[model samples]
Target: MTAPGTDAPSTSAQDDVLFTGVVVYSTQDPEASAVLVSGGMVAWIGPTETAEGLHPGARRIDATGCLLTPGFVDCLPTADGAAVDDAWRASAASRGITGAVPGSAGIREGMRVLSPVAEPLPLKDLSAQGVPLAFGSLGAEDALDPWSWVRAAAHGGDPAQRISDRAAFLASTRAGLRLLDVPHPGALNLGVEATLVVWEPWDFTVHSSDIRTNAWSVDPRSRTPMLPDLTEGAPRALRTLVRGEIVHDVPGALG
Candidate 1:
């Protein structure tokens, strides 16, 4: 993978890559620790030991102390009339955003709201009512950092109206993709396009709107995927991959 802010070296579709010793966040296999990408798609995902037996010649990426998850998708409008370009894409990739749908029109079946909402609308209630709510950035530049919207929605507004951090995260990722009617909205799974982001390790906690349910939610049996502890601030992206191709990487991140 190339370093951040530089164009990624061209890679063949047949190239194979094995990422080991990383925490993989996937709905299909929450406990997975390794992923093998082949032909620009997810070939296999499971325990690191199992991955060792597959794709013997695949390039290896020792991603210990990292969290691998689906990249964020941004639904944003132009920034001060500036169109989305390579620089903007690089900036977004650096922040763990892999795909974007420019402009705010034609987004039905789900609600897309700007963050730091000036008016507190019963967001949690709307979600509970099956509104399929999602968040967008106020400006194109701010859109790059998906956590900004997550933080604003999860922690802002009246306590009763605030959504849980997990809910906010879903709105920023899968929910946005669902709004666009993309097949298999979220990117993590076997045989899906390997659009992913590896983030610096950070603390995580299971958050819920109800204090009574918080304890049970953290139980291992729940198989819940913990998200970054927003109170400690958002984790930085160490690398970003689009369809298994390295689009951005922080220098020495894997070393």
Candidate 2:
């Protein structure tokens, strides 16, 4: 879980970073103005002034005009013969994935590609390495089929059905895998490791009305793009953190 030129923020008093002027999508609340990270956890969250006052010595990450949300957690199963390498990690980082399942992959020679099978995933070991592990089909593109089906059923249809579909997708993204019996997965809760992603939408404004009435628009800033927009690509991942360590910070991506 290490990246070149990126080290975990220290636990010392001077290591704190007051991340201010961004919309924080914490699990505790759907939104916050700021988040203070210390020792790889969210120490506090509030207005910019309060966060600055509480940690005067902390470095400031001015997140003005940005939208921050929990990092994407991908539970990818390793190809039995292909060792996980820097390329994969780099690719994941590019997609706003800071933490993943099976942090390390095994190596075997003479195979071009390997298929995923229904084997017991190393959830505990990966979690130990700070991977936000989950069960189910991370390796399959159709893993989101169920979500899509429900969403389609809700489209221009019953309001109750839309709400149910939306709730299900949110749970699937956040904590449903654990409910289905995956062990030791990460979550965006206070006191947990600081593994989160910040996104900046290209053209869309994540409106307050949409969050309440539109089931399809769950956190429009999310890089995953809960709502499929054929006209525009999903939001950009401005920053990604694993255990409060900056894994990806795209310069000039957000302004």
Candidate 3:
């Protein structure tokens, strides 16, 4: 029988990737310290030393002295200019944002939409280009509703799987940010797609950005690296992954 409060019941050795030497933040553990990924989903999570024995064949990536978390999921208000699609994606990837739900009024290149389009071709094109499709009604016109949307979705789910407000509003790249009644909006659980991000811890010696905003200190909302309102100055994204693929990676981020 599986022991209570332990993830051994779901552990498996077929994972494709293993991340070690970093602190993993998830709905299951605030700092799990290690994560195992397989087939674009998180297979298991626990201590770093124990991970190797679980998946010996997995590709090990060292994240020494860094903070590991889910990649950011941007809400509405992305630019619709096709000419700047690459630039927009680069900027978002640099900031640890792996997916986005653009405003309905504009057609932003490479954006994932909350609601499905009437035409199947457009949806297929986006998916072919690596965009995730989900359902919802979050529009740019309804700006004030997002605050409540963020709160309800992040904190109102199963206690163990309830995602941090930061992760739900900032690091959830799976689309479907338009409703308030969904279950576990952004919880990081086993068998879920491995969309992840890494951030370098700030030491007194390193030259880190000091872009402090009101959101950081606020109780339910910490100004994580990937909030849409955060225009300038924040911790670096370091690395990002979508469906276990390296969507963005900077020098020294893997280590």
**Candidate 1 local lDDT, 1-255, one digit each (tens):** 554556555455568888898877776776788998898888888898878786689888888868888888776665333656787788888999876655653335556454444335678888888776666564545445788777777877688888877778877788767756776645367888888898998886778766777897788787777777787678999878887778887766664
Clashing pairs in 2: 71-196, 71-197
Q: How well does candidate 1 score on lDDT at residue 189?
A: 79
Q: Put down candidate 2 lDDT per residue, 183-242, tens digits, no spaces.
A: 322334466566667666433232211345444445435422232221333456667776
Ranking by lDDT: 1, 3, 2
True-structure lDDT of candidate 1: 0.74
The lDDT values for all models are: 0.74, 0.48, 0.49
In order of listing, the candidates' clash counts read: 0, 2, 2
Q: List the residue pairs that clash in candidate 1.
A: none
In candidate 3, what are the lDDT values of residues 12-41, reduced to their tens digit? 323477778765555565446677888778
Q: What ranges in model 1 sit over 4 Å off? A: 1-13, 78-82, 105-107, 116-119, 140-144, 185-187
Question: For candidate 2, what is the TM-score?
Answer: 0.57
